[model samples]
Target: MSHILEWKTRLYLFEEDGTTKARATLDTGTTTLTGHGAAHRNPADTDVPEIGDELAAGRALRDLGSQLLDIAERDVESVGARSGERTDPVLGWSL
Candidate 1:
């Protein structure tokens, strides 16, 4: 069977007091998840806004991905199946 679903994601970034912050949101029709991250630049380092943005955004996305995996694991356990029973080739690790 083929399933067609649409999920929406939005990422917002901002800087304050030499710190860059990022918030990422994912909407999966039935549930919504959010992740947050921050990056602080050293005073002695070059003040690069783009670098800060990249660091914060990457961290936020990583957090969001972890949350997604947690939810999937819980869902599998809810159905009386053990989570991480098998390894996924793409992920190269057990779920």
Candidate 2:
């Protein structure tokens, strides 16, 4: 069966003192996760707010993606456990 679901996300960016910070949040009704990122500009370099915003936002998204993957991996790891069976420290068979 095909399933359709929606996840709402909000991203906020802040800049001050040549530094940009980003926060990304995802809410799935029952669960909420947040990712954070920051970027700093060197005094020698030109102040580019857009570049900082992009970098910080990208990092936050990457963090969020990693969190989701970790959750999925943990969920998958549990599928191998059965009654009175211990979960394997290493997932799947080592080839």
Candidate 3:
């Protein structure tokens, strides 16, 4: 069977008081998840806005990915299947 679904993600970045912060939201029709991250530049380091933005955004996305995985594990368990029992390398590695 072929399935088609659309999920949307939005990321926002801002800088305040030598710190750059990022917020990311993922909407999957039935559920929404959010993640946050921040980057701080040391006083002795050169100030680079772009670098800060990249660091903060990457961290936020990583956090969002972790949440997605957690949700998937819980969902699998809800369906009467053990979440971590798969032995296929591809499936095992994913969990």
Candidate 4:
């Protein structure tokens, strides 16, 4: 059987206070992205901690997505070279 190992990512988001929030740990086995923030919302303020959490989480997930895409692209190129497959022009030949 051909053994294929895959990388996995995990993301977590939560509120820290009434107006503070965080997005913690975008992990891909060996790498992680973390973000924190203070929403600074008052009784009359339009902002909320949930907004902060969403913003932070979105940013973290975007970063993680980019990294994961890079890893996948590299792996695909590696496999294509090993198997003598014609890779897409955009991907090009790695070696």
- In terms of lDDT, the best-performing candidate is 1
Model 1 TM-score, 2 decimals: 0.86
How well does model 1 score by local distance difference test?
0.87
Could you estimate the TM-score for every candidate? 0.86, 0.82, 0.86, 0.46
Residue-level lDDT of model 2, residues 29-95, one tens digit each, is 7889999999999989998899999999999988987898667666656886322223334455321
Candidate 4 deviant stretches above 4 angstroms: 1-45, 81-95
Per residue, candidate 3 scores C-alpha lDDT tens digits across 19-74 of 99999999999899998889999989999999999999999999998899777777
Candidate 1 structure quality by residue, lDDT tens digits, 1-95 = 99999999999999998999999999999999999989999989999999999999999999999899887777777877645543552234366
Candidate 1: clashing residue pairs, number: 0
Q: Candidate 2: list runs displaced more than 4 Å.
A: 81-95
* Local accuracy of candidate 4 as per-residue lDDT tens digits, 1-95: 89775555555665544544444455445765554333444567665566766766676666655665666667866766433333444346432
RMSD of 1: 3.1
Arrange candidates, best lDDT first. 1, 3, 2, 4
In model 3, the runs with Cα more than 4 Å from the true position are: 85-93
User: Stretches of candidate 1 above 4 Å error?
Assistant: 85-94
RMSD of each: 3.1, 5.7, 2.7, 6.9
**What order do candidates take by TM-score, descending?**
1, 3, 2, 4
